[model samples]
Target chain A: MSTATGLRRLTPSSFLLFVAVLAVAASAAALIVVYRTGGGIISDQERAEALAERDLLEQVDVEQGLDTLAAGVTRRALFATAGQHFGLFDARGQALAGDLTTFNPEFRNADWKVVRVGVKPRYTVHVIGSTLNDGAVLVVGRSLSNLRRFERSIFYGFASAVAIVAVAGLAAGLVMNFLILQRVDAIANTAERIAGGDLSARSPVADGRDPFGRVGVSLNAMLERIEELLTGMRTVTDSLAHDLRSPLTRVMGALARAMHEGATEDERMDAVEVAHDEVERTLNTLSAMLDIARAETGLSREMMVRVDVAALVEELADFFTPVIEDAEQKLVIHAPSHPVIAHGHEPLLRQAVGNLLHNASQYAGEGTVVRVSVEENQDTVDIVVADTGGGVPEDQRGRVQERFVRLDPARSSGGSGLGLAIVAACAKLHGGVLRLEDNHPGLRAVLEIRRV
Target chain B: MVEDDAEVADYVAKGLRETGYTVEHVPDGRDGLYLASSSSFDAIVMDRMLPGMDGLSVVKALRAASVETPILILSALGQLDERVVGLRAGGDDYLTKPFGFSELHARIENLVRRRAGRSVETVLRCADLEMDLLARKVFRAGKPLDLLPREFKLLEYFLRHKDRVVTRTMLLEQVWDYRFDPHTSIIDTHISRLRKKLDEGFERPLLHTLRGVGYRLSEQP
Candidate 1:
């Protein structure tokens, strides 16, 4: 196959196959060397045996005659003790002695060789040949089946070892892949659940030191922020509906009374007046809510400029003092001699301060002292409106700043509960905060805004 | 009057006619612009949203054509930014929607009055009641009257638009620069106090209440 095709088919098994091929090649080369060396050792031993037999025959010839030595029983006994075959051939190529019935062609010229001798059980032998003193040929052979068996055993051992190593490597790789995929699948499942609107679901962070763990942590934080914003929006919508329903119901009732059959002309006029008043009140509430909403949208950033908070407070005090006096309340305004400047929408700041003052003199009972003060620090400008009347309870102080949260509904005057909410929105828009504090005997509402 | 909604147009036109002013109504920006440029009118009331063209563009087009009639923008967008946009587009005044007719009438009267008196006047007088604008003082029958600063401003707005009905919203806006509704009867209380100073000993009352509408300060009352 082409290299590209081989690479495409390469997997964990393919890697193991490559390792096995390397091991098999090495084992086969080693076996060939061993077989050749063993055969050489066998051939040397056979050649020594044939020489010893010739020397013994020579000795016998020296002692006696050649004809006598050839017919002797001593040669047969020597071959049997050596466990080898020895044949002597004369000049005419005829077998002379030592169990050689016929002459072998392979034993004619070469010095040594491995040749098969028997047919029934096929015995391979290492054979050595030499020319004798009387011009006769002598050949010696030794069986080599044991060396072949050893070679076979080595080959089998190497093959099995390669197979075992490759299997172990592939198993390890698969186990690691499965573990990683399980972790990744867990993360994906959590993401899917969150996408399906189950924001309560969170990604599992097993090891925070890992990259995936960090990503999960960040995602969970983002989800928390989203949930918080959604909850806040829901609360605002619910309260808006609740606050608008009252005036709407009153208007509907007045109109129904006006349309009733038993209503006289005076009663009809009174109903019309009542409906008009209720409609105006509803419009006022809606407009105030819109103002708060606008501040929250952050669209007023373009209108931001350096506002003289002290000047604005002075103006509000001037406008409300008469109205407060008419309500039979004492109004005191304290402003710094130097200009107290901050960054915000001037009109919105005026409205926020005005709302606070309005709340103070209106909610705080008559004969109460209402004080308006403007103070500046290094970072913030605080416009505080304090009254010496019954203040909001400690727990209710925070709740009172929420939209449409009216305390003691039975004690409500003509004002909607959106004034402080608008003030809070404006404070947030200006990158500041609103705080409600106790003035010992009354409520002190402070609107803190960032300074330029 | 130029308003796209037929109901609103008829209602405003009828109200103006009942107040004894000759009125003309158009329900589209194109027609309104055409009539405004071709004919002479004392004043124009334009809605911000119209059929053929928007009110701001119409005002821009009229100003570009040199039609110098005073224009009052009537818009449902009551934001301070919207008010700034309308005035910058050459509208003499900006009135938010769902307004009381008395408020609309008062704004339109002020716009027309501003256009009529282009030359600066230092003194304003309604019969024996007189205000010296440069001196910031008020006099009745050659006798000096002591009035609070806010009352003086209230009387000054009245003197500027004498004999015309001024709504409570107008007084709050023109005098105190407050654009919100007065939750209490602050204006009424202030007006009663000012009346005590202006007509307490005088035979004739200068400030007359038009129930269900507003107050009209005139010699006849």
Candidate 2:
């Protein structure tokens, strides 16, 4: 492909300028050809008028009307001599003698210019009447000067018009480039900066009337979303350290006191167990925190390695099959025939799906079905984990995935309340989304990732 | 000197007394200033947000009086601005609440020990004991004494204040960071261990105990 094809290409200004110059040249050529070819009829009529005037001159001593001052000059000689200076005509509207020797039929009755030689020469034969006896008129005319002048003016006009049009085309080309391609260039530059790690950069949004402006608005919206997602992520990390450490200090204190002041072996053992539990809680919290932080900061776009979504779903199903059987609960995984691929971090995605399965197995009652499905629908890839347990309420579902929020059952059952929240954070980090819906009989949680 | 939150004041005051400090607790900025003006302390523990005069104003007043008392500020606003306010008010150190007790006590003790800057350096020895510090170790009768981290720090502070009465609160601030007056047995506890290791086999003990007041490290047996 040419540099002007695909992604890398020559800009629109050069392209428009090329087309404009080509159009001007083509127009000038066509008009020049028509003026030269079809306009020869005017010259042909002048030549015919000269021939008619010459015939009239053969029957008359056109210069006998001149007095002693012109005695040496013959009629034909004087008429021809005068033709060198001007075209001459008699009363008959005909050219008598000149290089322009014919009277064009179309112009035979037209009044002709009549020039007579001599002042007070008693001239009577050089007249435009029957008295001249077929001396109706005679004109001695110069050849082709008017036609040449007309053609030269047309050439000059064509040259000036082309020059003016070319300059105007240049001006219009610059305006077109700035208004159209230049705006695109501005957006591209901003995108380049953002790609180069300036997340604070934003496209200059013009009025949202033209396509470029609309694109600017759209890009700004996307960039705003990106900025918000990143800031929220930062808050979560800072919150993690600040919030997690407070509880940890108290736990460490309790354990330290128990170690130092426990009265008996049993008391010491109890304290040790409690400390171990706190440590475990801290680890679980950290795991959830890292997952959410990574997902919220748009880490997925840089790592677009493809993974088989269907295979992952099947593998998860197989891994959890034994647990399901042991719980006397039904487990079913539905996948497409063709391997549906999604760009993602395989380990993280698997962990997310695993967490869902773990939740389902723990919360969904025995002898109940835990349905899992991974499917692709045009622009989206969805991994769903649904449980036959009581569905989350409409009002509560939104809050369920927030950090450290859990339904009553999950909370009572010793959950950290961070499972769904982590999942939501992961989806957002990947520029994806999570949807919580009722499965009519139970709750359906969907992890919807965009197919990049 | 801290007069902000009641709970924190109680915690810090009790921790200080346990570390062998004579603590005069106040409730708010007004009372704190009145107590500070009327009394003399080796060090002042100022809390940033007080009821009336505030920790900043109190410290400012103290500094204005040309009272070069070593002051340590306490605050719960752990942000940068709070620290600036404390330091600008002439506090020698700034520690936020929810802090470890040991750290606070240690800071206060160090502040006071430095404040009592004696002009002449005093040589400290017990029972014809002699040691050269330029050599980086101590010896008694040409035998080196193996000291733990805590014991070494305790001995060094005592050596620096050789001829003076080193209070338990002074030792706590110099050694441990316990800031409250829990009236606990921390000073006695650490002193016992230090005595056992340093003067166990000796005929006379140089470490002396002052009942109802505090313990002191002396050069006489």
Candidate 3:
């Protein structure tokens, strides 16, 4: 309902959000994999080291007594190692012997787990404890700072990756928004120009593969059609003025003569008659122009029905036959006996075909033959009126089909010059085409309509 | 008369007066409605567009007030479907503008005569020509005359308006119901043929062609 560019409503920010979410998920997955593999390696190694120390202490305790084991030189060697610590405790949980006994002892019995014990620069140590048979306790701890450092590095890297991906997605979204707005603005500006009466204005076409390009093509086509219609309207207006003004002027001249003081009664009567004739002629011209306008605007489509083209053409031929024969011309008709139906308004079709036949009668000349034929194909029915008189020049045939474009001065006397124009309009309204072609010795006017 | 244009109203009123009919003209729709409802008249000629109210509204209001005087709507918008709208708005008849005065006068008289005759009549006679409505038969001077269906309808219209001028347009509209004009002289051909049939063996010609006006089927001529 807003008629605004839909780009803003379906904004590019949502796409940016989606990209950001995917980046976060991928970064999280990488961090989790790194943490699990690295942590597992360090924990497994630390557990093995603690188990070996515990086994050593248990063997020494079983083979020798707890006091003898604590007093052995091997116990000192174990405590003296670089990344290992050992402790011996009595049943009161006091460290009897170890390298560092100054740490607090919060120990669990018979378990292997990591413990943070020291105050400054705390060491995350994986420790194992066992209870000897003589009510003594032994503990072993391993340092894990190297593994922790590696994991911290991986975490920082993942965090920065997520931040960079999010920023890049936002920048891309902004650029896309700018491009879409530019294209939309171009279309709106072109439409505004066209609405302001610049019918020649058109939108710049984009690449054919993109939606914007297709939209531009369609908009340009619409503008072209509007321009054509506007140009046609101007032509019709000018022709109407030129056609009606002459008759009106003649009427005025005749009336002026009748009103002259020196005119005799009989002369004034003749002038009155002339004035009346001119008035009628002007009215006829105006009416014909109106009819053409009406038909061209599709006002007659509301009266559409199924019309038999063959029957209609035959009837028209019969009606005009006597009239043509009376004028000393031969009238020939050729039509199918079967019904060839089309969707149309009967009166409008009649008027269109009648105009063509009347043109033939008037312009085919005396003693010449005018032939009307109805030909039906799969989808169309063509009613053709051909005459054996002086035909229109090939170059002027197109112009003569236009309103008020009379090619023959001698043939232009009685007609308002809208006969063919009306026929063409009617044919168009009925979803058909009107063609003017050259007969062997005359003109052939064909009005083709869609069959029902 | 209800019309906005002074020239048109004056011209129509003068023509009606020349034809020996009393004329009264009102300029706009409001006063026209007021006078038509309060007084009695033979017929009212109303224009479609007026200063106060439109012709359709005025007709609707009068008909609502039970004013049965015949109303003829005159409009400049003569599209193919416009006449239907005018008649649907309670107008007795609709005539488009740029019309000949004879056609207008004939239509107005027809409307008035139609209003005056309330009861249906089965037989119509103009001088020696008699037509039976139910039998579809015509007798001229007590002699049966054969007529085609179209000729019969044309004669019926002529007999209906025996002493008045009926224009070619009136005939086309009343008989064939064609609103658009034909470029050929179809009506003239039909009329000439009908004239030959009616006057071929008759003593006096009842159909008279008035130059510059139209045809009349009357005994006085």
Best by DockQ: 1
- Chain A TM-score per model, please list them: 0.55, 0.58, 0.65
Ranking by TM-score: 3, 1, 2
User: In model 1, where do residues sit more than 4 Å from their true spots?
Assistant: A1-194, A199-229, A259-266, B64-66, B182-184
Task: Tell the DockQ for candidate 2.
Answer: 0.01
lDDT string for model 1 (A1-452, tens) is 69989788876555655755675577668767866786567556666776675567656656885465556523663546434665667757776765544566777654557676645666666666665557666665555654566567766865676567556756765675576667777778888998898978887877777777787777778777678667767887897697678778888999999999999999989998888887877777777777777787777667788878887788778777767887788999899978887888876787788788878777788899999998887898888999998888999988888887888677357677788888998898898889999999999888999885
Best candidate (score: lDDT): 3
Q: Pick the candidate with the highest TM-score.
A: 3
The model with the greater TM-score, 1 or 2, is: 1
Per-residue lDDT of model 3, residues A300-346, tens digit only? 67767888889888876765654676667888899999988899877
> Local error of candidate 2 at A76, Å?
18
Model 1's CAPRI class is incorrect
Candidate 3: clashing pairs of residues: none
- Docking category of candidate 3: incorrect
As a whole number from 0 to 100, the lDDT of residue A9 in candidate 3 is 74
Ten-residue stretch with the least lDDT total in model 1 chain A: A73-82
Score each candidate by Cα lDDT. Answer: 0.79, 0.65, 0.80
State the lDDT at A15 in candidate 1. Answer: 63
lDDT of 3: 0.80
Task: Write down the RMSD of all candidates, one decimal each.
Answer: 13.5, 19.6, 6.8
Binned by DockQ into CAPRI classes (incorrect, acceptable, medium, high), candidate 2 is incorrect
Q: Could you give candidate 3's fraction of true interface contacts?
A: 0.03
